[model samples]
Target: MTVAIVGDIGGTHARFAVWRDNGLEQIEVLATADYSSPESALAAYCERAGLSLGAGSAVCLACAGPVSDGDFQFTNNHWRINRAAFCRALHIERLLLINDFAATALGVTLLEPNERLAVRAGHAQADRPVVVIGPGTGLGAANLLPKGAGEWQALPGEGGHVDLPIGSESEAELWLLLHRQFGAVQAEDVLSGAGLLALYAVVCQRNGQPAQHANAAQICAAALQGESLATNALEQFCVWLGRVAGNHALSLGARGGVYIVGGMVPKFADFFVRSGFAAAFADKGAMGDYLADVPVWLVTAPYPGLLGAGVALQQAG
Candidate 1:
């Protein structure tokens, strides 16, 4: 089957795949960190699949951070991509590079209704803009706007860097703690995986406890294993995430819904539903009612960005 090459590149990995006609098929993943450059990693993927670029197949790459002039400059990863390099290297007819969050926004429409775990049962229709966001290495945000019937345009945003408005006095204290360590705090200071650990450290310090330095994975593991401190931090992180997501929803007027897409949150789906997240989301004073009626969904599909890349390729083609 004739297919196009596509990828959703993250800091650590690039999900590589090809879509046959209009359906997704032959999906693979390569570690972006495994190769020093995106070109080398992409070459490995093509080689393993025995795929040649002479078909002049259009290449679509969805990457974390910003995309400009068909080039992707990832903030967290060292890879700097130029479309010309890939087009020449792969002998492709065309190349398209897009923001990963934008890819997620596009992918949401492709998700099955059941694929979404709804946090609030409200009026969610397809016409209104749908917001997509998640926390991994860092936070990513995007929104899908209706262009025409059954057609949408994904817009990437640097929502993660927005200032975190304090929700309560305790949260204000948390902000102060974060500010001491990192000047000019962004929402990512508390909403990301690393941000969760930072929250834990702040909590530990306040309680006169030894701050347990841990990574995102380690903290999440401890939380799942009934570690009270870790669990508390994770719970706090979830609430903050929900609050920020609600803020995003308000800004986007995303009455259609908010879709959470990331590797981190899906694993903590149960914990999220049972945590203070829902309450925090609706805690906005006057905006509380507005957000209370807007539903939130978590994207559970794997390799969503690759799927999004495929969708982008189809549209660009």
Candidate 2:
């Protein structure tokens, strides 16, 4: 019974669990701000869970940034980690650190039939390249290509940092407002949790009113309750999400599917389903027919990164 410790580390929270019997057990979530470093946080989680790492056990962490030369720096947080130090500290024989979205892309394939909700039913062919994009504390994107040998490859990219796409006149105005504040408005500028608050603020300013919410959560909550200002912001968020998702699809030729996964979208599933997401996704002018036939899926599986870490370890073996 060889079990591994799995982690999905993000800017706002860190998720930890033990992978056993192809599923996660003893799952725990911690606020990233509560710890000084990822090591301390891992130590705390292990201590609280009364778990120990054996000599041959593997440690896999799906991080929120690029992993280069066995080192990773958090994209939205301040924690930096070297794989050697982390492995030494944990006394583990194997370690795998990968981009969080890469993990999500791999995990998307492992999802159960009911774990996903199909947003657009397109003609998806088996084993074609697929894209996964999600927005949470930050935006994440990845592509999954099947290797045709019962294995798959996850390609990680920081597509979220691309320039924001303004679709409408109102959106252009909103972009101008955001640009004035942030200098260069990347997709992450309006596609992340902090971006939600920025959108709400800009929308409020556009309507000649003061921002009524102080944080992203507050604004989302207000929007969920059908508050006018927050609802406007939420709609704007979904519209932009559709535009960006379509762009990613076209760029990658991801006819297999486009999966949306994150901590944010599932919170407002109803609004997302009813919003202008589908229309905007298929509104690529001349390429509308091509995109209209591309399926869009919303991943609902919990602990997708943990599942992906297990997949990585299995593949390595």
Candidate 3:
């Protein structure tokens, strides 16, 4: 049995779970703002669960930012950690940090059929590249390539920072307005949780209506309740998400398929399916036919990042 500390740290929330041979155990979620550092968060979780880390217990964390040179700079949080410092703080012998999207990509390979929601039933070609992108507190993306018959390597990249695409004249107008405020617009600007709020605000402003919701959750609720403006904003988000996924698929030649995972999409799977998501994904002019055969799946796994962190630890050994 391989017992290890596995975590998924995001902008607003951090989750820790015990990784065993069967699956994730003792899963817990903590507010990121409640703790000053990852070490403190882990300590709190351990105290609650009556668990302790041994001298050389394996630890792997999936963080929502770039990790390099044994250092992690959280994209949305203020925590700054070095591998050595973290080890000393947590009293762990070995620790590994991986990009959140990379972890999601790796976890996709281990998901069961019941854990996946079929958005598009296209052909998934083996040995081809796979792309994973999702919107949570922020947008995340990664690619997976086959290493061998049962092995794969995940390539993490800052794909969310890429320029947002505009397909219609109305969208171009909105982009100009947003560009004036932010200077440069990226996909994450209007594709994440905060992005949903921004989208609703902008759309409301454009329609000469006052903003309605205070946050993304409220906006999603209103949209589901048949609020016209909120629904419009949500639809736009889905369309844009689909377009971005298609772009990633084309760029990576992700014939193995594209998987959507994060805190957002799973909340309203039916809404996403009925929205303009599929149409936008296959709407690429020249590559439309090419992408039509590439499947897109919505990951419904309960704790994918934890699973990925466990996989990381196993692979390290």
lDDT of 1 at 100: 92
- Which lDDT tens digits does candidate 1 get at residues 85-193? 7678778777788899998888888888778897766888668888899988889999889997799999998998998778889888888999999999898888777
Model 3 lDDT per residue over 1-317, tens place: 36788899999999998888847888999999999988899888887768865532778899998888767889998777788878887788888899988888888889999999999889998989999999999999999999988888989999998898998887887787778767789999999999988888888888899997999999888999999999999999999999899999998899999999999988888999899889998888988998979999999997888888888888878
TM-score of each: 0.95, 0.96, 0.97
Q: Give the distance in Å from residue 268's predicted Cα in candidate 1 to where it truly belongs.
A: 1.4
Whole-model lDDT per candidate: 0.82, 0.88, 0.88
After best superposition, candidate 2 residue 75: deviation in angstroms? 1.2
Model 2 Cα shift for residue 40 (angstroms): 1.7
**Clash number for each model:** 0, 0, 0
Write one digit per residue (lDDT tens) for candidate 2, span 139-194. 99999987897577999999899888888899999999999999999989889999
Error of 2 at 57 (Å): 1.9
lDDT of 3: 0.88
Estimate the lDDT of model 1.
0.82
